[model samples]
Target: MANASSMKIRVEELESGMITAENVIEPGTERILLLRDTILDSVMIFNLKERYNVDEVYIRKNFSAATVADEMRAEIDIHQSLSTLKEVFGSDEDKPLTEFSKEATKQISNVTNELITSLYADDNILLKMHQLQSYDDYTYKHCLRVAMMSVTIGKSLDLPRNKMRDLCEAALLHDIGKRTIDVDIIRKPGRLTDEEFEAIKKHPQNGYLLLRKNGSYSEEILNGVLMHHEKYDGTGYPLKLRGEQITYLARIITVADVYDALTSNRPYRQPWSVAEAEEFMMGGANTHFDYDIIMAFLAAFAPYPVGDRVLLSDGNKAEVISNNTNVLRPVIKILTGENADEVIDLYNDFKYLTLSIKCLDKDGSTGE
Candidate 1:
């Protein structure tokens, strides 16, 4: 039996290498399925779901703060994913989309599987997403970041396994159409001409065509790629489909696509702060994006999750204790001076309303 302190999570939440807190037994017999303190792996998790019909299991929450953060990082190899993407995108320069379809789908599918695994492997999904903010303007990196954000949002909405897998792949390939366009226009430092913007808008249709040509992707994935640019207010390009008229997965990807685009640095403009980018995302909920998906994105893209140490505006240090309703103004415990360990609810407590988080603390110095 799990102790009171052990966190009980659903089977789908299990991560590789997480130690079991208690014995998992077969339903009919007294036979123990897995012993207590068992280090979990993919096979054990699958059997727990399929063979034993286990819905939830207890895991030891004994990792250090640094180790806890590490669980969410480097799930898929960035270099490997980028290398595979470059190979596929390179085909756009030499071979036709048709020529690379099979190999591309196979490799992308493998990466998507790893992406899903990495997402589920930790409790701090937003932390993983937040770490993605510092990425470059490379097409592969942008697509990868978008896929991570979209999947994080999808997980927040409780999307099923198959749908989530489809969503990730769609987001990863949503910008695939850009590969077919001329490199100069895509990377130009100056503002785009109307003709160039129009050409950029064709990416969704182009990506849809490329994936559809493969005949391997699901309709949900294909539609997501085609309609990711569709706005909620019917103002976006291509189909201009609005509201729920857009496919569900496409709607999810739309929020993530815009968020990643805003946060990522460009040739012409600097990257927006995470808080600034999130505010923009929240502002566009009903017009530029789906309201529900935007809400999910907010919930999943916490810039300051609990357990993160931060530097305060007034030159103090604190650890985030909770990320209540307001993502920016979370409950925090001051780590400086006389008020050490005192919890302040930045969103609710009026006494600390004047205070603000400046940035994440690389080192929790007392600001002395």
Candidate 2:
């Protein structure tokens, strides 16, 4: 039997199953029992005849004799409790902000990993865009979106995986300091005074200190929080480190942060169109952002994402149903006077095409 530190079991080994209580066993307790490898694939828990929710179960040295029926019962109880918590805390009415914070942080990490992997393979951008659009709260959604965009940009630039993960973690935690800022300042629907703006600027330091106090994150993560606002031209705040003095991860994150902020609806201003935001970023390149990172970002972002409806230059309407192999061109489903879902491959039909995204609708749906 493998020790807990290096426990190994195949999916087939867990077919018969064994029982182990995650909570009942002490932290250092080392008892081996036959268990389904749920950690390998959490979805497998639903397939098991018996369920256990204590913590985790491990395979034992015995060949084939173990009972997991009781364990499955415990799992059901735990799952029920979790479901209750989700219903109560995740309700639209008035859930506590603390609970929301925890859930948001968890989601940020999960989405960051997904986004990083998606940059290498062009599969899930639409799903991710929809997930981002569904969140009602701006802070959580903004942080998660920025982290995703930053990780995508990093991967497009061919950064190493470990470095990219660190950047993602940093990007996810970048705005955590906002929790320390005054609620009034953060939620203000109008333009702030110079003093209020200064107060808001302190969030990076506040976030860095909060993470430091927690004593769990690495220095690079903290630095990312501290320096993400710094600019290439040395006009940024706090330390004001310019050019190469700022960390590479921080540089990448800054571009992503600004792009998301501009494109996302805020209390003070309507969200800018993706094309408008792209133009703004292009103008800021080399002065506020690293030019190469900007190039990578433009390649990664979809100005007219799939599933969005848009109005073409010819006055006909269409829905963007898919992206072309190249990121610049997308496959749009044109909706003319009588036809719907007429797939138009922009790459092949360039001669007759002069369409552009006017703006993103409230649901991020487009028409052209």
| Candidate closest to the true structure, highest TM-score | 1
Looking at model 1, the pairs that clash are none
How many Å off is the CA of 246 in candidate 2? 1.1
Expressed as tens digits, the lDDT of each residue in 147-231 for candidate 1 is 8888888988999999999999999899888876767777677889999988887888988888898899999999999998899
Displacement of residue 286 (Cα, Å) in model 1 is 1.6
Q: Lowest summed lDDT over 10 consecutive residues: which window, candidate 1?
A: 126-135
Overall local distance difference test of candidate 1: 0.75
Candidate 1 residue spans exceeding 4 A from truth: 1-76, 91-100, 123-137, 307-319, 334-342, 350-368
- Model 2 misplaced stretches (Cα beyond 4 Å): 1-123, 302-368
Candidate 2's residue-wise lDDT over 92-115, tens digit each?
Answer: 333222322444445444545655
State the weakest 10-residue window (summed lDDT) of model 2. 31-40
What's each prediction's TM-score?
A: 0.70, 0.56
lDDT of 2 at 160: 92
